[model samples]
Target: MLYSAKDYQRVRKEKEELDLGRSQFRRDFARLLHSPAFRRLQGKTQLFPGHESDFFRNRLTHSLEVAQIAKGLAQQINKRTPAFKRRSIDLDLVEFAGLAHDLGHPPFGHNGEHALDDCMKKYGGFEGNAQTLRILSRVEKKIQAAIGPSDDICGITPEGIDRRLGLNLTYRSLAAVLKYDNPIPLRRKKDTPLEKGYYESERELVEKIKAHVGVPTASTKFKTVECQIMDIADDIAYSTYDLEDAMKGGFSHPMQLLAKVGDESLLTKLHEKVAKEVPKVTPDEVFAALTDLFMLNGADTPALEQYTTSKMLASDAKMRSEFTSELIGRFMRGVSVTHGTGADIKFSKVEVAREIRIKIESLKHLNFLLMIMSPRLKVVEYRGYEVVKTIFETLDSEEGHLLLPDDLQVMFGRLTDTDSKKRLICDFVAGMTDRYAVEFYSRLRESGASIFKPI
Candidate 1:
């Protein structure tokens, strides 16, 4: 509602208008849904490794869930809040943000991301959020034309001008996906892990986006209310759905977890993990919360024993589905918006209730402890790290550099500096899906396949 019709306009106008009876936000959603980047998410890892099971959720499905939750949140806000009821939140824009949020994630999820970051340490660092911005603004293909003389032709130039317009997304839609405002530092910091932010190379474009979206120059946290909604929806989907995946895979059982509710060591670990984001959370609070949620009826026995002995709650699909659905509904109802004026704006800050936040955080911690950090997953993650590292090294070497695709070869040749070339290499490897990365690695190391084998 803070935006005007002009703010939803694309960077490059279409030659002939085709009124599909869709709003600008809906069109933005369509553009992303049809993109190759979004499609590649089907092959990218979500919680478990992609190759591990056909039933596990991939990045594509995860994004779809996020979009649904985001739209639901937007609708809830519009129905409940007075200010939103007057101005109305755009459901399409919120959905667009959620769908586009993870478009830039590399193969193998966080493990692959860490590998790419390590490879790019000497160059500008790699962050999935930063890559998402880059993909939207510059990397993904878009319409183009020669704006200048033919003599200046270079990489990605059909004529004399290189028109890498990406999706040419509208300002408000772009703002909704600009999850972090800070720029990654040129030099690596020894004391901390690589921070997630926009790339320094995209700084001017980011500023342009902010200006168009009417964000104040001096605001410390530049997130828009729609972006905040998308962020919370992402958290909700991750906390609830990943747990469902683990349960289906039999990696975690609710009754078993309930039995461990009083285990001091497990509770301590959960507390430590949760406290990283919510500093004041305690072990007892997390345990009590999970116990309350998972325990069925007023059965007198310990939850663990009851779950083990009782056939109804343990294996019932309906029960599990109902529990997840109820949690999502509860969290959705917890969302609230605050309106500000003047330099401050209406619907400026969106928040979930403190108790709901803690519950979601606890769910996330349980997922992390029970599934993501398990020893079996660690082995797969390490192999993923090696695969990404080896592939980058092979392509970066002088002999192997010759084997790059023609387009990348041209881009690499045009960039003279070491860091620039390295960054391009990072881009190439980071765009790969999990299966592609593994296949490429196998071709380089084990298969000894034909030279004509396409990349």
Candidate 2:
């Protein structure tokens, strides 16, 4: 087998049942599927708030879409490449990567993440990618170690250790989601709002993952094929689906976005970005690409340059769906496997064709600017930042561990180290969904708060 037995080894050794027929990766997927962290995703924000319209995708739906795309992409590569056909990318593994990819995004999306990072500047800075690793290794309460009768509600820990084992997932499963390998610093040089590495708390587990997965200990970078596919799937999803939400929300349409073509500054920003990513694409090529991509229905190109209001909604639901489907198909056609640095599965990288990537980047930046940066969403984003920050502060206050739920409170009370305690509070606050975060903040600070409210 190309993958060694160590790849399937879990951190805490336990008696295994007879194979019966399920793959280890499938078990990993099942574990994540049934976890509270995964379930919380449904109430978390994606491109827009879930309550505004059920048609808008939440984090849960977006994750499911990513898993579908990642598995499909893996199949496409395996079917086309002889080497990959011989040592096929595990479809279940890629799907698990996709599903677990966003498991660490706090309530209110990036806004919430930023709030948590700012709060943890002195402790290990918070990052969604890093938090994902933390959750898989230690945060989730699937397995607990040997503990006193008081600590274990069920019994003296089944794992026979003295720590909480997040999921006791296989080493390969942990490696699949280890997006950024570096341990996050206590304080960044620039104090960036977000950091892209794992927390110090999971440092030991991460090292074990690398050793078990056959990645060189000295390697500076590490990203498995499945993780790359999951990342690409995530990009493809938000870029297309978020645009669908915008159109459905009556925000703007393709032709209406032509107005952006007139903004030389914005176009230059986009041109530089496209040029950087796609190389050799000129400013004129960018302008032409924009017009070619969005100038549909034989719409007069020159008039749309003057198009302003979203009221010019020239497309219907059928048109939007067709456009999105065609775009997604184009992206899929662009994918292939290529040689890469590092060891084992990390030795390969997924490449999206330049032309298709150009379209993807264009559409992504357009969605980010037009929808994510829109004043309409900005108001909510600002509110999200405040809510998340407030909740973190309240939970970290004097005697704050008292407010945590019984399960979290038990963990928090046992920690004596300051950093560990603060991290426990950070985890408590970061695990909330958008709805829950709002309710939490309201109960703490809002007037006429009900004591009957349940977290």
Best by lDDT: 2
> Model 1, which residues run further than 4 Å from truth?
9-18, 145-163, 189-192, 216-219, 298-305, 309-314, 448-452
lDDT of 2 at 424: 82
Candidate 2 has a TM-score of: 0.91
Per-residue lDDT tens digits for candidate 2, residues 1-455, read 33678988988786665376778888888899999999999999999899999899999999999999999999998899776777888899999999999999999899999989999988888999999888877788787554556546531133333376788898888888887868888766445657788998788888888788876434356777788888889888877888888889888877677677669888887778777778888777777766766766455545635343223433466667777888788788889988443344454778898777777777788788778888999999999999999888988889777889876676666665778878888988888999888888888887635778655
Task: Return the lDDT, model 1, position 201.
Answer: 74
RMSD of each: 2.8, 3.4
Tell me the whole-model lDDT of each prediction, alpha carbons only.
0.79, 0.80
- Which TM-score value belongs to model 1? 0.91
- Per-residue lDDT for 319-413 in model 1, tens only? 66787898899988888887665545523788888788878988887888778888988888899889988999899998677767887787677
What TM-score would every model get versus the actual structure? 0.91, 0.91
